[model samples]
Target chain A: MLAIETKQLSKSFWKNKVVDNIDLQVEKGEILGFLGRNGAGKSTFINMLTGIIQPSSGSYALLGVQGPNDSIKKKIGVMPDYSSLYGSMTAINHLHYLADVSGKPVSRQHCMEVLKLVGLEEHANKKAGKFSFGMKKKLAIAQAIIHDPQLIFLDEPTSGLDAESVIHIHLLIQQLHQQGKTIFMTSHNLDEVEKICSRIAIMKDGRIKKSGTMDELRAYYQSTITVTIKHSPIRPADLSTMQQWLEQAGTQLDIKENHFTIQVESEQKIAEIIRALGTYKIDIYRVDVEEPSLEEIFLEE
Target chain B: MLAICKREFIQSFKGIKSIIIIAIFLLTAYYSADFSDLLLSLSDDFTSEEKQIIHTVGISFLIMFLGMLFVMGLSHDIVNREMHERTIRFLVTRTSRTSIIVGKFLGIALFWFVCLLTSFVIISIFVHRFDLITLFQSASLAIYYSAFTVLLSVLIPKPSITMFLSIVIGIAFPILNGWVSLTSNVWVSWLKYLFPFYYVEEQNYSFLVVLLLAGVMVGIALLVFRRREC
Candidate 1:
């Protein structure tokens, strides 16, 4: 079953579309990366889904419960981009207060566990006002997941963290995924999305430009193979000779300086290129082929 | 809701505005000794017929100052400080919006009740030579006036606005009431009844009016907060 689903959801502020018509779905326990550049309606979409703001049109459901349902709210968690903690309260006080309001039977030990998970155990008794930005972010994370919510919406979770903290947050997210928690996180960090997300949707101008698993997206958009040859300086005319041979063998070529970059329809043509280059007594230095990154695909779209 | 109420009550002092209000109240109250002789000398000019009026007006000034403090502390804690700190989002997520608004209103009201009761106790000790009956009457009146002022605090968005309106009503209504009493003008007399200060003059009927007004204000605050966007 899908943990979250939206159909034709749209949101506007003062008749200006902040989030245009959008359709989205995330299955149970799936880590779906919501990728977009800044102001690409990523945060706006998440805000609507979490009921932080009402949508201008369309409908959505959380765990089969429709929008604005109180029961659905209990099953979902949200960590907004900003820290919304009371500055005067100690970290433990904030968590305890939230636990009480959530009506969850959380104990002191559970609070400590959450603090330890976020590596804020030592600072649990310190006022949140004195906490660093990263610590406050961790506190926000702890508050979101304290109730062990089934679905979590995390917006730019790793944006302001140090490298180590980012890795820790990624590990925490992975642990939650292992515990069968559905995570819908929005981020502009393509590398982090590539490492953590099971599937991804690339958004641009308030719409999903493309979406698929990494392998499926790669297969669909990356049909060309690029090879770099480094032996000696070769003229474009000389490279065109190689291009003609590869074209006859059913491939394309782009040459620059001493490098011969060839686009092949299939891996079977690699052997043909080697055989054709063997006839010219040209030294084949190196061959490198890579699928396009999500960044490249997003830019191309 | 109880958890949120407790949080708001305790967090009240954490706001800079609350601290400044408490500081100003304590400082002004303590230092008012400088003017006590002047106030006592003015009391000598009152005839037996006007003694009650003079005492009521003197107590009203003290209460008004305290009301200003209450308004500053409560209004900032409820509206301005919460928005400034950006903690309302976290609060709304954990508790319902109704719970937040109602809890804050009640919590600040409770804070004012405690502070007013304490201040009245001190005043009674100094003025009545530790007479228990005098202490009770003074404290009861303080509580009644505090409730009225706290209600005003809840309705107005700013402390200065509440204080300004309270002062205007407090000073103008009594003069109008006196003029109506002398001239026997029904319209002006009826207008005086609309002001909260009219109810503060006599202890018997005024207490009931104060209570009813507090209840009505609280209900309006809750209803307004229920449908509030954030």
Candidate 2:
């Protein structure tokens, strides 16, 4: 079953459409990465879905409940792009307060578990205002899932974290997904999204340009292998010889700075190029082949 | 609702804004020796009639200041803090908007009630030496004024504006009642019944009637606030 579904959801601020008509869906137990640049309406779309801001038009449902429904609110969790916490309360107090307000029977044990999950057990007694930016972000996440919500909306969860913290958060998200939680998150870090998300939706200007499973998206935008070869004492004749070899093998080649980057349509041609270069006794210092990354696909679009 | 209320109560004290207001109130009330002495001297010169007027005016001013502070605190607590901290989105998942509005109103009301009660106890100790009847009258008036002020806090979006309007209404209504009594104007006499301050003059009405009136104002405030966006 679909955990979340939106049909032509749109939102406007002062008559300027921030989120245009956009249809989106996430299957149960799926980690869907919403990729977009800054000011690309990624946060706006998440806000609309969570009912922080009502949509201008269209409809959406969470865990089978419709929009503006109080019951549905209980089934979801949201970590906003910015920190929203009571500064005077300690980190543990903040989580407990949210857990209580969530109308669930929460205990000291539960609060401890959540703090541990966020790696904030030591800082739990400290006031939230004294926490660093990264710690505050973690506290926000801890509050979001304190109710054990079935569905979660996380907006740029790893934007400002150090590398170690980023990895820790990613692992926590993975653990949640393993426990059958449905997550919908947005991020500009394509590497992180590509590493963890089962499906991705690329958005631009309040519209989704493409969306599908990673494999499906990769298949849609065919992967090209760029083979960079480093050679010494290269001359114009050597470049001509490389071009002829590439042309014969039906590959496209570009050369600059005594190096040739050959674009191979398929991986099968990679072996053919190696064999041809071996026959010519050309001094091949190194050969590097790179597949098309999500960054490359986004940039190409 | 209880859970939401508890959260609000605990979170309220954590805010620096609330602490500053309480600090100001305590400093002004405890250190203003001249004002306290003036109140004592005025009570001595005045007969029961003038004492009643002075007590009403004094308690009304105190309640108005408390009311304004409470209203501003609650408004900033409910609207400004959420937006400034960017926590509204996280809160939406745990509770409905109605719950938030109602919980915040009640939480702030409870806070004001405690503050007013403490002030009333202090004032009572001072006035008890003057006349036992005047002390009772002052306590009763404080209770009534606090209730009205809390109602205004819930209804108004801005604390300062609500404080101003509530003070004007509280003072003007009683003066208007005195004017109508002297002029013998039929229209004015009939309209005086509409003001709550008029009811405070004689204190002859049944306790049930006062309670009923307070309930009605609070109910109206809740109805209007529950429907408000954000």
Candidate 3:
């Protein structure tokens, strides 16, 4: 079964159409990254799917359940972007209370374990108000996963975190993904999205402009691959001969000192270039191929 | 529902605001009890039996007004604080909005009930007699005001505005009661019913009436809150 499906899903605030008609779907066990610019209705769309706000039009279903089913809430978890932990409650107490409300069988031991997983076991007795920003975010994650949900929505899970905290959250996401839990994440961190997301959908003006894997998106854009070659030291006359040979083959190349950077359409083209160079009796040092970065592809669209 | 109620009840007492409010209420109740005795002594127009009812009525008025003042202070921010702080999003996603409204109302009602009981015990010691009817009346009045304040908390966007508006309306209606009585017009006379204290007046006290009013206010709050977005 699909983890989430929406058909013409739309939400509006009075005359302002925050999220226009949108059709989206996510397969089970897939880590789908949702990306959009500010004021592009990402939060509104998530809110509608989570049942925090009713859609003005269209429909959506989560895990085969339709429209804010209470029984299905147990199977889904959410870490909202702007949520605040209770100031006076300790971390353990907060988790325990949330676990009970979310229909989980909460125990002090279990709560401590969840806190430990978030690197907050030692601070279990500390009030949430005393926690730092990174700690509060960890608490939010712990609350989201306390029920061991089949699916989780993490809105900006690594936003505003230090490098270490970001790495910790990324590791946690990897662990959850390895356990076969589906994750729907929204983030401005393209680098992290590229690292963890199996599929991605980019939204613009309340509409998805593109959705696919990184390779698929690159293929759709028909971006060229960059091939870097390090060749043995050669005389200036040898470089001229090599440039004429490349012109005869109609290959695009840029030479800088001892290295050559070639833009090729395919691996076959790269092999052809190497074979052509080999015929010139030029000794080769090494070759490295680079694919287009997600950031580049994202900005291109 | 029980989980939400339990959380709210426990959290209500965890803050210094609750302690401060309780202290202020206790001090006010103690002073009012002694003030009633002194006022009754100056009024020789009443016999000893009438003096007891008069003194009891004086304290009852104190409870009705002071209890509402406490409600306005304590409950104005109950719902809006969660919204302003963005914590309601957590509860709304996991539980029904109706449960949040009802649970929070019950929790605050519980807090106000305990405060009313403590105030009653202190006043009883100074008055030298336990007036069961007065205690019940004051307690119900306190609960009713709390319910109204809860409803207002859901309606208003800010706590300070809710408190200001509630106090203005609370004081305005009673002062308008005289204007409402001077006119013989049926509609104007009916305006007297608008005052929250009208139901808690000397001859108008009834446990059932107070409960019904509180229930209606809470029911309306639930319906309104269920439709509100986080």
Candidate 4:
């Protein structure tokens, strides 16, 4: 079954539409990265799916159940970006309370184990209010997965963390991913998303502007293939012949000394250009193909 | 639901506000019994039933004033606190929003019940004999006041503002109710229903009034809260 499915889901505040006609589906066991700029309705969409806010229009299904089913809620976990922990409660106390409410009660020992998983074992007795921002964030993550949910929604799971904490959270996310848990995460950190997410959906103006795998997005947003070529000492005659051959093939070429940078039409053109250069007796040393990064694709109009 | 109740119940005792309120309640019970004893010692013709009624009224007065304040303090932030802290997201994702409201109301009601029982223990120390109906009234009154406070907490975003408004309406409305009696207009007398004092004074019908009021407050709160966005 699909982990999450939404049909033209939308949310509005007065006349302002925050989530507009977003149809999204997340398959089981895949990390689906949700990316959007500020005010792009990323949180609103998560809120609707998690039952925190009702959609003004459209409907959604979670784990095959329709519309915020209690049975489905028990199967899903959420790490909200803006959620705060109880100040006076210890980490274990917070976990126990959340676990019980989620219908998955745990002992203090179990709570400690979960805290330890989040690197909060030593601070188990400290009140949440006294915890540092990064520590509280870790606790929020621990609470989200306390129930061992089938599908987990993590909103900026590693946001506002030190490098070590980020690495720890990344490892935890990888561990969860390896355990066959489907994760839907939203983050502004493009590099992290590129590393952890299997596929991504980019939202703009309350609509999904693009959604695909890394290769698909890169290809969709980019058309030219940039090939940098290094050749052995080429005489001026050979250089002129290579330039003429590249121009005839309709490739954009730049030459400086023995280095030739060619922007070709497609992947097929790279092989064609290399063969043409070889035919010209231009000895080739090395070749490199440059593909666009996810960030560049995301920032494209 | 029980889990939410248990956490809130424990948290109530962890703070000094709850302890201070309960201590003052015990003191009020003591004073009520003492005043009743002084009046009874001076009067010779008063029957046991009449004496019981006098003690009930005196204690009810203390509860009507101070008990409402305690209820206000106990429940004024139940819903808004979660919203303000942005912690409602965690609970709402795991449980139904209706469960959240119901669980919190139950938790606050339980806390108020404990306070009432403690008050009964204190009242028994001096009066030796207390009215069972009065005990029931106090419990119902506690529930009634808590329901309104819960409703106000859901309607208002700010806990401090909710408490301020609750105190004004809870304390001032009754005082204004006295002025309403000077005019014999039917509508003016109808305003007495707005205050808990009217129902607290009812000897035979207070039980029904308190329950019905609690039902209305909770029903409205649930409806409004269910429609509210996180």
The best candidate in terms of DockQ = 4
At residue A68, candidate 3 shows an lDDT of 68
Q: How many times do residue backbones clash in model 4? A: 0
**Cα deviation of A287 in candidate 2 (Å)?**
7.3
| Candidate 4 lDDT over residue span A177-253, tens digit each | 99999999999999999999999999998999988898888778556567898987776777777678787664567
Write the number of the candidate with greater TM-score, choosing between 3 and 4: 4
User: What is the TM-score ranking, best to worst?
Assistant: 4, 3, 1, 2
lDDT tens digits, residue span A261-291, model 2:
7777666787888777666666778889777
- Model 1 lDDT tens row, A1-301: 8898899999888878878888888899999999988888998898777755678899998898887665576677788777657877799887887777776748878988999998899998999989989999999899889888999989889888899999999999999999999999988789999999999998888888888898877776765555555555554566667666766765456566666666665667777777777776677788787567887776676
lDDT-best of 2 and 4 = 4
DockQ of each: 0.30, 0.42, 0.65, 0.85
Candidate 4 lDDT by residue in tens digits, B1-230: 78887877766676788888777777777777678768788878987767776655555776666666777866688899898888998998998777888788878888877877777767777778757777778788888877888898999988779778767776764467556644578877887675455665545656777778888898899899888777
User: On a 0 to 100 scale, what is the lDDT of residue B148 in model 4?
Assistant: 81
Residue-level lDDT tens digits of model 1 in B1-230: 77766765676566676677666544444344334446558657755544433323333455543554455434433543453455555655555656666676566656655554454444444444233332233344444444444445445555556656666755553465456545666656666444344555443544456556556655666665443333
**Pairs clashing within candidate 4:** none
- The DockQ value obtained for model 2 is 0.42
Q: After superposition, how far is residue A132 of candidate 2 from its true place, in Å?
A: 0.7
TM-score, per-candidate, Cα-based? 0.75, 0.74, 0.85, 0.94
Across all models, the iRMS values in order are 2.2, 2.5, 1.0, 0.8
Q: Extract clashing residue pairs from model 2.
A: none
| Two-chain complex of model 1, DockQ on C-alpha atoms against the true structure | 0.30
Chain B TM (all candidates): 0.60, 0.52, 0.80, 0.86
**Per-residue lDDT for B65 in model 2?**
35
TM-score, model 1, chain B versus true chain B: 0.60
